[model samples]
Target: MHGPVSAAWLLVALCAATGAYCLLRMRSGVEEQRLSAGGEALMGFGMAVMAVPTAVFTPPRWAWPLYAAVFGAAALRTLWAVRAAPRHLHHLVGASAMVYMALAMAVAPPGPHHAHGGIGVPLLTGVLLAYFAGYVLLAGARLVPAAGSASGGGSTAAAGIRAGAAGWGDRPELARACRLSMGIGMVTMLLTM
Candidate 1:
């Protein structure tokens, strides 16, 4: 229940909630939205698992390899589907990050040694930070109401806002917020390592 652990748990809860919402949204048959929903669910769930406190349950030696393999498959799937849905490239990056973390943690020497490994932990951390930071910024921009639009009464802008509100009710915005939250979470986790 210390500050860092508390924050990590909060991130995990946020990710789980987002994943659940995305899965619910997938029930709707919109193909494009469904693709995004699926990616969000995967990202959320993966991050939640990654953020779990080691004290709560240290992953067994086999678990890390299994996780890496699963995420490796996910990365391949993302690459194959990237042409169909370009947003999946982001999913690929997230999955790749998971793979990197899994492998890094697996090979990392036990005990009080630094978190950096022989395989360029700093480089991996930098890449993840940049990707997540960009995602958060772009997603945040998408969530904001455009300037001079809110003031025009009954304009397309207003309609857009209404649509956004409806979308928020549907939880896409919430999912985006969760992504941003996860990005922050990942950065925090990386820094702590």
Candidate 2:
């Protein structure tokens, strides 16, 4: 595999791991937790399929339409869920991006000419880059205090964690991390394209 392909595979692995963790958390018998399990799994699998190295496997023409349909449905679901919580908007954006990528790939020329550039491509890349950069910076900032406290004393970290005591599904930090991971993956995919 080449550099971009290798990076995509690494992202696939991370997304899969995150999805697996979310699935495990869903087993806790919490209604709210269960609601997101499907979305997480879909996101993971969708990214994996999109990231597959073209050398290893180039999806057939029909597959692109299928992917577009699947991600379109996912986008709709995420939009519906946004009424429950604003955070679901991020998921909507992710699914929409997937749809965009799928459509782009569907119309792309075959062979080495598949990856091309234009004003639209650069615009999308810039927007995605800005969003992911902000997300990572904000999330990293929030984690800083936690890291500092944890470094000061292990018990302090434990105490902080215990006080929070949220179910894995409800963890803001983990959710942020997952979003960041997906953002990075999206950016990587876009750049390769």
Candidate 3:
């Protein structure tokens, strides 16, 4: 992630935490949730690893290709899963983006001017940035309880408390929050790339 060490560390924390939460979400009784959570967990952890500052530890020459291979496989898996549930399409996009970033890094190792120089394709990066930005906005909007729903003692706070009352894997709000955080983390990583 060729950036300030502090920003890198922050991204690591955000991604790792989101990954851990997704791991917990795998226990969901819902098969769809389990499948989606697994992919999201992989993405979160992968992003965390990739976000590590170059000053701290420079990955070996082979590492970038390995990343690409892993994410490419993930993208394939998501593609297959999308046949059953269209929601998995997002996972496919996320995995593909990861693959793109990995290949970009492999082509051009991090340097002072890597962001503007030879890191990633400008057009593709811009597309990804737009996609994730829109996703973050849409997800954030969904998180807010509707004004009408907030009436009848079903205020946003009350709804949140009810959602939190459920078990980890069953908490829809938490799951959405986890996804939202990952979206923000992805945007941050892409910007740094």
Candidate 4:
């Protein structure tokens, strides 16, 4: 009957725009890498937007199936990717948390699952946020000191070897930025809601 012309839809649109930009920034340069780290958080933010609306907007019969099919598929894909790219810890954690969010809502009573408010209320909301916040913080910690010197320069790469004046610290910034993006997006999503 009623389409999601609600304020929530606006949030989703904002998320989509942010997500795309994040994807792009992830490719920017060694200096922008810290920003790229935020991408995972952005992805989480996008998924949360989609989830909140679908859960709140869907009618009966379709709710469970929708949750299972969409979120489940995304989560599963992320999980598979995690195994395939075991080195990508951000992907792994982001996907795992997404799976947790899906499961959290899947069991709610029929129809407009999000209408209850309990799903996104303080408890679940806090947990969802904490996970993402921690994700961003981790990435920030990893990227600090050198900020934009992924051309090696970070403390993490200092011990290994040296490469020119930058001393391996001037590597790239995307990996680190993606990490921050994920966290920053989480804060944005949480604030928006």
Candidate 5:
């Protein structure tokens, strides 16, 4: 647990929890479906991180392909979200991160001419990472709860969350919880890897 393998596994747990939270919160709105798509993206990446270290974790030979699929699904969902979104930089960041993940898996050549990781220094990859990171921050700042409910009945909507009395729509606290959980998980997975 002191190195990359440990780190990767930790991220796996964090991401899995995030996915679980999304599942629980998915019952909130007409737009809840969009969040589900993003959750799937995170789950795909989490699975990829899990598969990266072991050559026989799954259909052994399909390792890279699995990663490729994760990258693709995540990228596509992000793109769709951005297209459907209302001109928000947060949406753009999420989309960029997905594209970056895909590029990191396939676009880079197998040499110094390509990125070694960390999304490259001065390229779209860097922009993607930054964007995704921003989305994570935005998402964390607002957690959509079930429609018509709020921890504090007097709460108001901010950051896409529409809180109500039935229950909290997306509230910043819930968003923060999701962020912290996934953030911890990402760190853990990266460490294991």
Candidate 6:
């Protein structure tokens, strides 16, 4: 978050809004949805906080380590949850990335812009950027309607559409889109770092 203040605030808004939506998604009757949404909400809010511009309010010296600790615990939780839901592995990666970012920020020099210096390993950031870039592409693809679908006059497809349109919490496509947005945001943050 060493960029312009406006960009930082924009990221904050995007992440906070996504976090709010994920909170609503937690109300879904599906247990898996609830679990995933909870984890996503955590990520969204955490990213928002981390994205805050340094000029606005720099966190205490201890805060970075706290962030690392919290995200490290989140990574562990996601690791355990992955046993029940394999998809939680993505959450694990997200949490681990957060931990990495936190540690990087912690070691960064204090100044007008917390220059990354050599604290953030270029290779690791490159790996994370590549991973999230691929994830964004894949999640975005999942949100797009498939070509040649028999939805022109198909009653089943129509009913399925109607069902998916019922509530935001139950819509798989929106959820995928949300994840895509987060992946993009992660890529942006990593680039700034």
Highest TM-score against the true fold, candidate: 6
Note the residue pairs that clash in candidate 6.
none
- Please, what are the lDDT tens digits per residue for candidate 2 over residues 97-158? 78888887888776644454543555675686677667667766775555455565465536
Models 1 onward score TM values of 0.81, 0.80, 0.89, 0.47, 0.52, 0.90
Comparing 3 and 5 on TM-score, the stronger one: 3
Query: lDDT per residue, candidate 5, 1-193, as tens digits?
Result: 1234554465555666666665655665546544743554465345445434342243333444555565566656556766766543343444334444434445444432334455435455354445445555666656556556555564454424443333453443664566556544433332232
- Those runs of model 5 whose alpha carbons end farther than 4 Å from true positions after fitting are 1-3, 29-61, 87-99, 102-125, 132-164, 168-172, 179-193
lDDT of each: 0.71, 0.71, 0.86, 0.52, 0.48, 0.85
Report the lDDT tens digits of candidate 3 across residue range 1-193: 7778999999999999999999988988777788788999999999999999888888987999999999999998888888877878888989999999998888884554465464455999999999999999999999997879856867655565677755657677788888899899989988887
Q: Residue-wise lDDT of candidate 4 within 1-193, one digit each (tens)?
A: 1124464555565555546555555554454343433435446454545435654555355554554455456556656656756655555555545555445455555543233354445666577678778777777887666555556546544543353333222344443554465556555444344
89-169, model 6: which lDDT tens digit per residue? Answer: 888999999999999888877776655564554888899999999998888877767665645756544576676744658
Model 3, CA-based lDDT: 0.86
Off by over 4 Å in 2: 1-3, 117-120, 151-157, 160-172
Clashing residue pairs found in predicted model 1: none
- List runs of model 6 lying over 4 Å from the truth: 118-121, 154-166
Superposition TM-score, candidate 3 onto the true structure: 0.89
Better of 2 and 5 by TM-score: 2
Minimum summed lDDT over a 10-residue window in model 1 is located at 165-174
Candidate 2 local lDDT, residue 81: 96
Error of 1 at 122 (Å): 1.9
Per-candidate clashes come to 0, 0, 0, 35, 32, 0
Worst-scoring 10-residue span by lDDT in model 5: 184-193
